[model samples]
Target: MAATLDWKLVVDTHDAPALADFWAAALGYEVEDNSALIDRLMTAGQLPEAAVAEHNGTRIFRGFAAVRHPDDPYDEETGIGRGRRILFQDVPEPKTAKNRLHLDVHAGPDAREATVARLESLGATRVEEVNKGPAGHWWVMRDPEGNEFCVA
Candidate 1:
């Protein structure tokens, strides 16, 4: 109908690279690199070399990068991307409230609670724990930026 929605999630953060790194490790996603494209741009004098920066052996736009589930589509050569991803973009302002949109991660069995604890160990904090209607239970937590996410 609507061209079959291409993606299912978007997570925003003030520190895109650090946020991307956190999510990448937390969600088992691989950090993406666009070094080749940057390289091409720099070589053609279309972009300054300073615009490209390297991190963890991957080249990307300076001050910005992203990560995605490893099995998801990602181009090795150009770093143009596809599949599940979280693009970290640079932004100003410390997050000051619950996010209007938040991620609800699935943790198996008593795992939801355990996941909450784990996320807390990783700098996330519990905001609330509550049961949704039948067959649903979740714990709200804030990311490092105070943006909220849920584990259920």
Candidate 2:
């Protein structure tokens, strides 16, 4: 039988922590805290001091950070989400093309405008308004790092 597997969406960013923070607020999720694990790894000489950095007084992997659903289960030792999550990893290259995959946030009909405005305040830029008449309506938006997503 095919087995179900836990998974997370990974996003490439120039600044992992900042992108993670933005997504966490945008999605009403919580930033994962993996400081304890980092500390243990560093003490064991497994991870180098240069591999980590301080964020909000906690140590995070220099090139990675993540956000998780607030009500989801997670590994206490590693701070890894077992349910819904988004992992951000740093990449040296800038975004060069439109995304083939993107997130569509559902805010329903009445709240679309308000939701779009809120997202804009959170560092997302409005790319365009997409109106499908009877099918649906949404706003194409770009995150701080220029990743595309929609608010519908």
Candidate 3:
């Protein structure tokens, strides 16, 4: 038998919470609410106030924030998701090149344009439109942090 391991995709960003918020809205995911865990850690003196920040009326790790599928199970004590999720971590440097990996959002051909427009309204920018005639159509887009993704 094979063992199953849990995992999440992490993205480097200048602002972790903001990026998390953007992704959550974009994917209809929920931002993990770790305030209770944060408070407990603070009371235990295991985490410093300097290592936390207030975002969207909640306290989150200073350089880390995450979003997960709304229907997924999570650890209530830690606010860690147990299913599909994405973590945004703050980094000192800006993105200087194309992403080695990217996300492809499937909205079907009929909804592609509207989906791209909605993503744009949520701070994503269109990089280019790719059309292969009868083959397919997609829009290469960039998130607020310049990470690339495709809407098809």
lDDT of each: 0.74, 0.93, 0.93
List, residue by residue over 33-151, the lDDT tens digit for candidate 3.
Answer: 99999999999999999999999789999999999988778999999998888999999999999999999999998899999999999999999999999988999999998999999
Over 28-143, each residue of candidate 2 has an lDDT whose tens digit, in order, gives 99999999899999999999999999888889999999999987888999998888899999999999999999999999999999999999899999999999999989999999
TM per prediction: 0.81, 0.95, 0.94
Candidate 1 lDDT over residue span 35-97, tens digit each = 788888888999887777777787778768777777666677777566776777776666666
Residue 4, model 1, lDDT: 25
C-alpha lDDT of residue 140 in model 3: 98
Clash totals in order: 0, 0, 0
Better of 1 and 2 by TM-score: 2
- The ten-residue window of minimal lDDT in model 3 covers 1-10
List the pairs of residues colliding in candidate 1.
none
Off by over 4 Å in 2: 1-5
Q: What are the candidates' C-alpha RMSDs? A: 3.0, 2.2, 2.1
Off by over 4 Å in 1: 1-5, 8-10, 132-135
